[model samples]
Target: MHGALPATLILLAAAVLAVVACRQLKLPALLGYLIVGIVIGPNALALLPNSEDTSYLAEFGIVFLMFSIGLEFSLPKLKALRHSVFGLGAGQVLATIALTLPLAWFGHLPWAASVALGGALAMSSTAIVSTLLNERVELNTPHGQQIIGVLLFQDLAVVPLLILIPALANPAGGVIEALGWATFKAIIVLTILLYYGQKLMRPWFHMVAKQRSKELFIINLLLVTLGIAYLTSLAGLSLALGAFLAGMLISETEYRYQVEDDIRPFQDVLLGLFFVTVGMRLNFATLEQQWPLLLLFLVLLIPLKALLIFGLSRLMRSPSSVAWRTALSLAQAGEFGFVLIALAHGHQLLPPNLEQALLGAILLSMLVAPFLMQKRDALVRRFVASEWLNESLNLTQIAVQSMLARNHVILCGYGRSGQNLARLLEREEIHFFALDLDPERVREAAAAGDSVVFGDAGKREVLMAAGLSRAQAVVVTFSDTHMALRILSHVQALKPGLPVIVRTFDETDVDKLKEAGAVEVVAEVMEGSLMLASHVLMLLGTPLNRVLQHIRSVREERYDLFRGFFRGATDDSDDPSEQDQPRLHSVLITEEAASVGKSLGELRVAELVEIKAIKRRNIKGVEPSDEVVVNVGDVLVLLGRPARLAKAEARLLEG
Candidate 1:
């Protein structure tokens, strides 16, 4: 207990100072944490000598980090990004290994050691990459998604490689036979999880959430995360694997988002410790003795790994800028390399000098990563400017020359929904131009005499080329919510009063889209549910006109009928032009108003007009219920004809 106390205090002090220094410098806090680890580590000041104890506790950092990542990636989301997660991710890992194997062999390492080193070098730092991307608010960008996909695969690949490395040292059994047995064990564990894990998780969380206790919720989160991690460790996989599976199970439950928010503070703190532990393992003495050799190796390794990633990304059809960013962002050796190299040394697969050299290279590379990422955008613009400009110009020329039209509808995608929308517009003799990323689709559409261009709709040049400045309306029909939101922001900034229509898959994004100046957001799930309800009512012998009227009433209520599915949904009728209102007035409650301190029910608002919604500072509000109290500075939405609204506004002022 005495020993533990000082270790904890030292870590806390170091972490605090590091965070402050990094903050003051306007650098990422991760670099500060790592520098603290290196400065006070056993090799330096030796403030904490118990490396074993710190290492054990620090391992939880990766576990919780992997769990949070799994929470963000639900099954549906993974399916949506399968092209990156599986295709590009798998290709990058294999390609890295293939490229590194020859170099490892030429260094005079044995064949088994070469394979082990190749696997070790194939990984990129998820902890650093994820933190940097989150800090930069670029995790949703195309290259950011690519990095995430490859990092996920690298994490998964560690489990098998960890087992295989030790097996290669003493091949009493055939190497293939040992690998097959390990693979079978892993499959069994995963199969068991796939079949029954989510079922058990949902009910467990439901009961916990019923209690509505924050303490209990946090306790349950730790129990489930650590417990699952222990189980996977028992099955011979990495602890991170179990935590990831636990997160995936919880992801299927309604409480996933809440759990994520609750666990993030813990994950961030623990991950800081993990990086510190990693830095502590780097011995400055070994690095000093081998500085020249290590420096040469580091120089060679970074560029080669980056080149491999770039080539593989291009093969996956990523744009040149995106591919370059992804490559540079992941050009360093990963945290997992330390674990692999340690395992390799334990199995006698690597010599002491070689191990030291590899460690020095990896630590230096990680130290350099933050700076590279900070300059990533500038580097891309500087190096890839010519090629990117040529591509942009070619696409813009094609779009304007072949498809541009005055007062035409500008479509932001040419997917299934986009094509359908274009056909309807064509039937009405309305001209349209489309921007899509799928080159094959663009070629086919152009050959069919339809106006379509190959380009990302989120680009300013692409929008301008599609005649966004002159277009009568802009409609975004893609389901990529980030891209759709980007296009919406761009168009709104260019033309604030333009009628922007957005199509989304569900209510998850309806309010956000509407707030971003979308004139209307068509939610597929809500519309489908409405259609099904109408059919059921008709089958029950309700008159067609009555059924249609009921549907219209439900929709007119802003789908309040479906609020049970999506809680805390606000009234969207605040926009005047979107509604069939003669006038929609936004009246601010004044301090002198008689109603300022009164309950909404006392205002006799029902007799005057409807209280559509209310906005307050720092709160997500919907339509005000009758029990709400009127406050000064509250913005109230009063909906009625022009004259009635005028009287209501006067009364509000008087109140």
Candidate 2:
């Protein structure tokens, strides 16, 4: 409507059009926003006459974005990832600086400029990587975790680097003096914000928010954001970084989720504008002139950075695939790179030409990153099938061999039960691998070093992962009889000689499982009945020992009948006297087992059975040497040669 009104309206129109078009193309809305900025940029269609104002607005967007990051930051969350966030993060910063400083100097920049360039180039874009990963729902993946950790560390570097650039221009004092002063001021500001902001900021927000008006809250959010930004600037740190710190402080409060949700719209709009402004900074003339150099740099930059970050991830002992994904996710420069470069230029620490060149590289890299991430799994598969990823196979195999190798246990399902089982296994010193259908579960478990993942015990491919070929014992927690049969069939195919303990909720699958080579088919209903029977007996005034004996008899009788008839039904009737048949010794009574009311020495059953391990529902660990005494409900890991084991098991069944 005014001087720049028509042009401004046109740019807004282009921004909307770009968003709609990008949605159609299935690209990020931010990419479309950038397209709008580039199309209307001074160097291009020139639809927008006010380029400088656009840049300022874009700068505000970064402030808002950083503030959002701060609000989300919690001391506990950071503490949880401290090893990666601080240790790995700091290492990446130093290593990147060390690696790139020489390269920048070789490019003919002055030492100070070289240092600035090195710092700027070493940083990768967290915003871009996060957006893509979230879109793919892979943020929960191992690589995703590592990527988030490293990016946080990279963001942590931005504040100091920004301060350093401006301080580098001040020749009156040495670097150490400037550094000390900067550090002191930052500490003061941080301490003041945490100590004072917590008391005042929340109340201030409540007072402002009570107006129950959106505009009031928006104004408050802005004030909190820019107010901190302004304060941080006066304290010799970047306003964006300061705002981030303030947001983090407020994030810990009850109002944080509301604050984040409330300000999210503004953050998105501003952040989008910021990316567009960045895109507008891409000078096509230079890209055309130096496309070759830019391409070479892009190729070299991504691989080199990826290699460094990957090595850092491995140094953190992050799983191998996770390390690669993190490296790839962060191989390109991030939004903070823009912030740092802008600060450097503002301080005259970096020249305009370098900014333009690096900006072009970064923008191009960002545009390609999502595609790369989407294709990551495909790439990993190819490499993993080859010798390339072979050398870096995650602990899946190692875990299988270590704790899982012997008669340990094979968890047939990686659901809630399986997860708990593994935790219990750790304490009991029982080696086990969790088998499941979910890839993310496997990845997450692997990252936690549980080495339990990525297999459906139902599938041969999955069994191979669980090392079913070597596993001494197996536990199928999944209760679906049909699925159990399918899994049992597959497992038996792989290891016909291996003992398989199949879990089922129905009796229909018992004969099928035995025929398929399962050593035992455990029906949930049968176990429950015996447990209920024993509990009822003890509750009915039967002595605990008599109750224990009764339950033991029941399990032995049921198993003997099942094992006998199961084999007979399968045409392998070796034992016809189902009652006289030797007890299945594989079933041992723990201190808590129904037999727990009895003692090994009291039962004189040390000669009767072997103890596998003891599991207490209350505790996750095993005693390796569980005490001879019985406890209430203690799961006895028992092994008897056969007849004694079955008889010992029969003791549980006695009425």
Candidate 3:
């Protein structure tokens, strides 16, 4: 027991270090887990023994993974993507297997082994591909949709394959008869569970939820998931199949998301262990002896798979660029491929040398997957001529829309907030051009007489085509801080003085955006909270004028731009008496300036312009005192009327 404790600690420590390293290196945690297993397994350093107990525990990882997949198995989603899921996705999987079966059979593998190998090879890394697509904001693109559809079908295909593989392993009764009986049992079990399980799952979950104890809810969730799994195992089916059924049943209920959230931690840890066990199975001796075979397998896996997918996508009428992207995105072997390989090895369908070779090839392919996806755009552009023409035409459309407008606002997003702002602008007779990425949204909006274009505002060329030089201001209505920073950088490069307003979800990024040169950042959460508070105060009998003043004071305190409005040509419409309203100006204390080394009191421009702040080296000191000394590189933030501000700048530079 004591020895076991140390081994467990070693495993935990290694897993943590691997995950941290993977995160820092921007690689998948799955790779890290596999590497940890290889380094510490009995085949290598042997820090941990290859024990049945560890392998048994790791099996639950597969169970939870299937459960998660089951939760995502929505009827409506499949229906919506039926063409891609069933047509392209099924074609990819079936074609991959059909091609592999002949090759494996030619290599003298038995029929069952060939089928198993083929099933394993048919999968692409869902974790890696989906994450990269989301990060690149391409999940809604034509190829992204097709990629997701294919992945979904692959996940669903694993269920039947799981049942079939074990049946093939034991053909004592005869291969056909064994498969027939296994299929019968699976159908019967699935029917009973699906037919009755749905009826009981919702009410059962409701009962648990009514208990309102989070601990009890989690306990009940595990019970249902594992109980169903155990029942399936009792009926001679895989535990993963039962878990998948359990997830599908619960997915029809309101508790599906809750169940998913509760099950993720368990799934992640166990899944990592599962990958580790897979890595341990990889014999370094076998790999050393079979390096050429591993290399051959790697070559066959990536390019052949890519070509196959590319051909399939083109056959389905996808553009060359879209087909290339989809092919590159899914060319790598998937995590489920490892699962299938492990399953096949467990069933003794694959030899040790062969299993090791396949594992090595799959791992190497996954490592190369990210690089391939990163270069997808470049590769597509280089290979596909239409891509360049498409982009140029898109830019032309944007330029045509903005050519007639002068001193108009440029909205970086045309979502709900952007639409609302456009309405407000329109009521005031202001011209604005909105940019959005969703083609559907752009089409509908343009049809509705909106001055919107389909374009990625983060792209420098897009902003240039949107007439950034002629625009009075730019407003980023989307709450993506990274994209906002990118736009800010472009705006700063093109026109540094342009006032760009950014919208964020919360104050967490307000300072960051401000430092990135945004004239102002409006936080949705802050504004929502202020509105909520104002409503509550009014309901509690606070006077309307008092509440309004309180809100104004809060805004003035929080937002520097709210303290005074910058004068524009439109300001002439305001009251004549307000023409001298105090405005803000910045004065840079250069080496040639007289105020370079002088204290605030020495400048004596306070009567004309209030020294609001001192900004030096990206740091701002609000309401700087008279005793504060001004340095050569300091920027004095002054507040005064237009006339006073000009006079104060001259006084500071020439005194």
Query: CA lDDT, every prediction?
Result: 0.76, 0.68, 0.88
Residue clash pairs of candidate 1 = 593-655, 594-655
State which candidate, 2 or 3, has the greater lDDT.
3
What is the C-alpha lDDT profile of model 1 across 1-655, one tens digit per residue? 9967897798899999999987766555766777877888888998877467677777788788778867866667667668887887788777776766675557776777887888888888887798778655466567878888888778767767766886677664587776677678778987898678867888888899899999999999999999988988897666877887888788888998999999999988987887787667667788788788788779977898888888888898888889989999999988788768867876799887677788778877887888899887678888786766776687768565635377678888888999999999888677788877666678899899888877677767678777777777788887656677778778766654455678888989888876665656878888899999999999999999999998888786764312211101122356665343443445667678777887777777757767665755412254578788888767676657556777777777774
Per-residue lDDT value at 266 in model 2: 82
What is the full ranking by lDDT, best candidate first? 3, 1, 2
TM-scores, in order shown? Answer: 0.59, 0.60, 0.88
Candidate 1 runs further than 4 Å off: 24-27, 127-145, 166-177, 342-349, 374-388, 391-655
List model 3 lDDT by residue over 81-180, tens digit each.
9988999999999998898788665788877888888898899999999988876667777888899999999999999999889888986458778788
- Model 2 C-alpha lDDT versus the unseen true structure: 0.68
- For candidate 3, list the clashing residue pairs, or say none: none
- Least accurate stretch of 10 residues (summed lDDT) in model 2? 563-572
Query: How well is each residue in 276-340 modelled by candidate 2, as lDDT tens digits?
Result: 77666667886777777677667877888888988888888977666777777788876677777
* TM-score for predicted model 2 compared with the true structure: 0.60
lDDT of 2 at 179: 71
Ranking by TM-score: 3, 2, 1
